[model samples]
Target: MTQEDPEIQILLDQAEELYSSLLRGETTLADATCSEILIKLETAIEKKKHELKQTSKTSQLC
Candidate 1:
């Protein structure tokens, strides 16, 4: 694991927390707010996953 691995994990952790809140049905945000934040977090997670895969491939080549 690298510095980014931990950082991305943190983001994932936070996202999960938010998801839990959303799941609990306690949030008052409109559809726009929910969709925007969820999209951002999902995109970040996907990007980090892709980066980690690339890093792993590069490491294997070394």
Candidate 2:
């Protein structure tokens, strides 16, 4: 199986922790809904993946 990118993995881990905190009623960002957090995380992961792909292509061209 392919390994996950470290940066993306970190983001996922952080998101999970935040979600867990929300479930436990310990989160300070009360205004942010779980779905909103998830959407932001997903967007960040996609951006990171795109950056990695661009970097790889640039390196290959060198």
lDDT of each: 0.68, 0.70
Best prediction by lDDT: 2
For model 2, the local distance difference test gives: 0.70
TM-score of structure candidate 2 = 0.53
Worst-scoring 10-residue span by lDDT in model 2: 1-10
Which stretches of candidate 2 lie above 4 Å from their native place? 1-14, 21-34
- Residue-by-residue lDDT tens digits, candidate 1, 1-62: 32656655665666677767767886555643566556766677788788879989999999
Quote the lDDT for 18 in model 2. 82
Top-scoring candidate (TM-score): 2
TM-scores of the candidates are 0.52, 0.53
